[model samples]
Target: MCSSSSSRTIPAALAIFLALLLHWSSAQLSPSFYDMTCPGLSDIVLDVVLQAQISDPRMPASLIRLHFHDCFVDGCDASVLLDNSDTIVSEKDAVPNAKSARGFDVIDAIKSAVEEACLGVVSCADILALAAEAALGRRDSTTANMSGANNLPGPVDTLAVLQSKFAAVGLDDTDLVTLSGKEP
Candidate 1:
């Protein structure tokens, strides 16, 4: 459940609009065009592309959607340890590992590796926070190289595609709506 190109790489204004839209929505409505503008396109898009490297061919958008929906629901909390953390929402009881979220989990690992290489030079948030900024930039580059397209997908489409795709997966309509996360 990945996003389409038309709605990828959303502007900042769109992201806020989309968030507000989510606030008012009822069922798993198509993320309103306004609320579809997600701010983390670069990272999300990159994730979809990378995931496509797998052979399953179940649509990258769907897989990505499931991950994002989960992350956003819990405010992208990296501490969502299945058996460890107490705050994880029990809806489907998400499993913690390299599969569902490569976000804060990998962000933490990268910070650790970078620290071992450079030592206490990076704050956890700085290392983890810029992940989206740095990732979106790279996503922009990848799209540029592919067909000289400016960006692969817009922010809204990125999220919507994920929703559509993941719905086909086990992630349900209810889980997405209830999503909460510590904002990055």
Candidate 2:
């Protein structure tokens, strides 16, 4: 009887530990994360995005899609922005992203502007997150995952497939509907 009670207590303690770890990890992201480091970060990103929108009406949607793709695969690390390198194959070359993923130039412009404002202080991953007005304080990943990119849901994916893909990423039916509502 004592052994059974101890086993249950052990599992409960482990579960609590795991829950706190996940919370702590996610709590690293804060909206004002770059406020002190990059004072005008959002303004800079917004200026570039607005400029890009003038030239291409689809720029905003493209950026949102880019952010979504990056997050879905690997938690918004900006691996999608990587180009072919000696050690990296780049998610840009993935089937879902090859032809459809775009607005790289705009990202480049934002990076340039941010660099000019605060050289080597801001990260590309953070820039991508800010441009999309999503989360913040994410660090860039050193490596890209082409297979993960390849598995991302495509435009032609069925409702069931989309739901499955979103579920795989810990998103629910409401998330599916909300994200699906965004148009490109």
Candidate 3:
């Protein structure tokens, strides 16, 4: 029921193309992506995220989780950034995100800065991607997940369940182990 109603199935070829597009958008993103269009883009976004992290120590992890949730729901197209409207039911209101998702204000602040610098050139998707990357360097606390955290693996979950979760996203065992190794 949490799945987006707006999501539609496509032909195999179209699905492949969309997958490639998402991969290309992520793989091609670089710190220098805005060098020509907005020379200060990276600095601006980094500063804002840093400030946000200082104000709310959980901001970094929230930013990372927010990006992951956004990507999971809508292929990292920044659909999560959309506020609820008459015709739009925002992903932010999803059960996984109801109170867990954060850093929207930071994203908005960064978006404003990007707009002032490069205007229409920067996409919200790019902002989210950049902010998630910037958030990596910031410190985060090792906080416990609250009840009903449906989207993440449980601490005592078996290896099979963990592997299955990764497989659902097209990740192999290698990716699962590699990602698991990053956990504290």
Candidate 4:
């Protein structure tokens, strides 16, 4: 049997461990990550996004959503961009993504421009992050997590359910509201 003090200490220790883990994971992201390998990466991404936004005002938001979905399923690995294949089921076909997610064409254009500028130097996952205006060092995932994509929070989910889902991803109420673009 554990005493009250020990029980409290256990939770505190667990919280600290989780915080450290999150920090360690995000510490790899840097604004200058592609400075050497892909000097023109950001400019290429920005140009494509700007052109896309001109044609579709919602392109910016859609790119951000695409980044969020990709990250949520498998740590921003660009798995959301995959299509149905013999070895992969694809997150795009998930209910939460189908008919809602967009900006793939923009991403493809960005890839083309980036490749022309600096071939094989950038990863699609990093490109998605850049399109969302986030600078991060990310790698592409060869496999997609269909089950994880299916479990993403939906439009009609209750507040409690949303909270639970966000919490599972180490996000809180503030993150939930901010990401949802809603006011508390």
User: What's the TM-score of each model vs. the native?
Assistant: 0.28, 0.79, 0.65, 0.82
| Worst ten in a row by lDDT for model 4 | 15-24
- State which candidate, 1 or 4, has the greater TM-score: 4
Best by TM-score: 4
* Candidate 2 structure quality by residue, lDDT tens digits, 122-179: 8898898777776577899999999889889777888888888877778667666555
Error of 2 at 23 (Å): 12
Weakest lDDT window of 10 consecutive positions for candidate 3: 135-144
Please give the lDDT score at residue 181 for candidate 2: 43
Residue-level lDDT tens digits of model 3 in 1-184: 1123212321332333333334425445455766787778788888998889677766755676677666544355677787766666666666667777788999999989888888987778778877776211111112222221354444566788877765666656755554454232
Evaluated at residue 171, the lDDT of candidate 1 is 44
Candidates by TM-score, descending order: 4, 2, 3, 1
Tens-digit lDDT track of model 4 for 5-56: 7557545544443343343257788879999998878888888988887787
Give stretches of model 4 more than 4 Å off. Answer: 1-25, 181-184
Error of 2 at 92 (Å): 0.3
By TM-score, how accurate is candidate 3? 0.65
Backbone clash count for every predicted candidate, in the order shown = 27, 1, 0, 1
How many clashing pairs in candidate 4? 1
